[model samples]
Target: MNDKVLIVGAGAIGGFYGGLLAKAGADVSVVCRSDYDVAKHYGYRIDSYALGNWQLMPNQVLRHVSEYQGQPDYLILCTKVTADIDRVTLIRDAVAPCTTIVLIQNGVEIERELQQAFPDNLLVSGLAFICCNRNAPGEISHLAYGKLILGNLSGRQEPKTQYLRDLFLGAGIECVISEDIVASRWQKCVWNAPFNPLSVLSGGLATQAILQNQENFVRRVMREVCSIADACGHPLPADIVENHIALTRDMPPYKTSMLLDFERGHTMETEAILGNAVRAAQRQSVDCPCLESLYVLMQLLELQIRSSSLLN
Candidate 1:
């Protein structure tokens, strides 16, 4: 039988990966908000530099989770980790006993809420190392790298995790299953902690520009994150910092997801991406002056955005 997958937040990352699952013959469905009318009428248009262009017509394009017809085998959550939204409340109704909840979002220490919400169901922590964005309604542009890492949060090797990896592989994308997903989250944070906020703080600079101008500052922030990760017992690889810098230097000059959100006048994931890490550093007694400074600046920026939105 085909896997029934329901995507809760079908933006760029969700839409692109959900489309790939459809390509792998999963009965994919989406619950859209902003692009509901367009996705319901037409379908998602995926333009990938690596895999080429394609369209994904979901089995259902729903307005809310309650509107779903049946229980899905997998419920993938790809929403931004922000303070304004309640991630658990968004998908609580649709979770069944057998359903495996997968979170393909950025941030460290974000898994406990979902695990507590549905203790009986299996939860998978996912990370997407890709440069993808939503150009417009129902349109996704996959600009660069598209690798996925998924692992069970409880440290159990489940077959469903492997199946999901195979699906991405079959769709021509690289997907790996990790034994320690928390460590993977920390590793990704080593890059995200530096580039994401710096992109916005630099007044909408791309990754390349930020690296070019503030390479030293970026490395300091990354090292802070590594220290926090080590203190938390999820020590990263020795060469992770250099590896991320090299990768960023080689990739196309691209705007980060945080910068894109700031440009769109939307709420950025300041708390999730930076705030959480800073708090973790505090809990571990790790000195992260650079990371803490970035967090404060972002919080002020978010306040400014909110104030501006209120005025206009």
Candidate 2:
């Protein structure tokens, strides 16, 4: 196996997963934007719930993909899929034919762009079921669960998939090999579509409070997401909604990543998680009232943020 892994966007998800891979003996190189100096000097400090506390100074800290000196085995793109960034373009130069580009990003209908951009190169879709936050430079707080599901968009397992799974598993993390990554994206959207937006719209309420005070609204949004998914030809598991509810009930009272992004005055992932889902529903003529409403609200919020930024 090619033991070298390059982590682009060294923030919460990137730092946590990349730190573990480096700890597991992979030749991991991390590329950071904001925390470049800190990552270069002090390395990453990951306080994981599952893997416990760990730190890494790989000696290969890079500020951008252009600084990478090797043909990487895995170029993991852990950046947030937002309106301001063209994800495919960011990883263009370093994406060799041998590189298995692992996109551990959140969004529906996001894989096609990269797949089209690099047809010959291997693409792996990753879903991170964890509550992690990077409140400051060189620091990652992994608050809760950290299981990862990985698969190609083609709906089949490749040899590379097993290698990636084993790589994460070797790092003392629970990793599952998925069959249909397309469906998996939609499945994740069920929970993401509602809570992420409502958390921000509700004047920054935490997960527990949102569920406690607005259970019915949450359920309705989830059901709408499921319906949209089914119309798009990927029916989710029957009890996934209940599973999310129970998971949230037992989860620590914490702010979501989207909420954190808004709180920190950064761009929230409004379009990827909610906008894409709503657009897909519209194509299939499926009525996603809840999703449509949330998308509009988030767009307005994003606009407000932009206007405020201009004045400052």
Candidate 3:
């Protein structure tokens, strides 16, 4: 396997995968912010809970984009979807012409934005069904599953894409080179659209919230999102929802990433995660009351949190 991997944003997903790749002897370089210095001084320490692993090392942890050396064969973006586009543009110079840009973000629109920005480069979409958090600098904690789903959203499944898929498979990461990538994305959203913000707003695990407070509301949101998916010609059947509900039931007690951000007083991934489904519902003339209500609730909660933080 090719060892040169450039991992942008050394957070939960980035640190987990990057640490794994490094431990497996891949030449991994994590592109971080000012924390790179401290990480370098100590090490990229990853204390994971789910994978039953921990890693501490110092390979290539660069602070500035200019300090990034060697053209990368793979540029893996593991940031939140709402992160600014300029971050990608900043690292464009470090990528070789043939570098494969893999976006390991939560939402659906990041690939769209990246395609718009880097029209010539190869862009791949990834969806991870895992629970992870960066509780400390240079440290990542995995809480639950670590399966990954990847696809070529542009519909061009090239040899390089196949190679990347094979690489992940060899790394023991479960992945699917989905043919119906759009359907897969939206279907994945069926789970995320409700769970992410609901977890944040209600302070509950997805299954707990679904079973405890509003089981019908959970079903309603899924039904509405599935309707939108069907209207968009990607019908997620009832069996799929049944299977996904089962999967969520198996997950450990973990809050969504948006809730983590909310707890930290940081801006949640509003536009990409929840907002995309809401906008898509509007565009397709599909009324999604649950999604709309959660969106508004989250906006209010964030406003209150920020206002209170500023006052403090």
Candidate with top TM-score is: 1
What's the ranking of the predictions by lDDT, best on top?
1, 2, 3
TM-score of 2: 0.95
Comparing 1 with 3 on lDDT, the higher-scoring candidate is: 1
Better model by TM-score: candidate 1 vs candidate 3: 1
- Off by more than 4 A, model 1: none
Give the better candidate number (1 or 2) by TM-score: 1
Q: lDDT winner among the candidates?
A: 1
Query: How close to the true structure is residue 74 of candidate 2, measured as C-alpha lDDT?
Result: 91
- Of 2 and 3, the candidate ahead on lDDT is 2
Across 166-255, the per-residue lDDT of candidate 1 in tens digits comes to 999999999999999999999988888989899998898999989998899999999999999999998999999999999889988978
lDDT by residue for model 3 (1-312), tens: 445788887777888877776665667887787457767777666665544666746457876545767777778888777644465676677767877888777775556667777778887788887777777787778766677777787677767677767776665666678766777877888787777788877754545655466656777787877888887777776686777677777766557677777777667887786788788788889888888998889779877886888999
Candidate 2, residues 230-308, lDDT tens digits: the string is: 9988899999899989988998887877898888788888888998999999999999887899999999988888898
* Residue 174 miss distance in model 2 (angstroms): 0.3
**Cα shift from native, residue 77, model 1 (Å):** 0.6
| Cα shift from native, residue 216, model 1 (Å) | 1.5
RMSD of 1: 1.3
Residue 119's lDDT within candidate 2 is 95
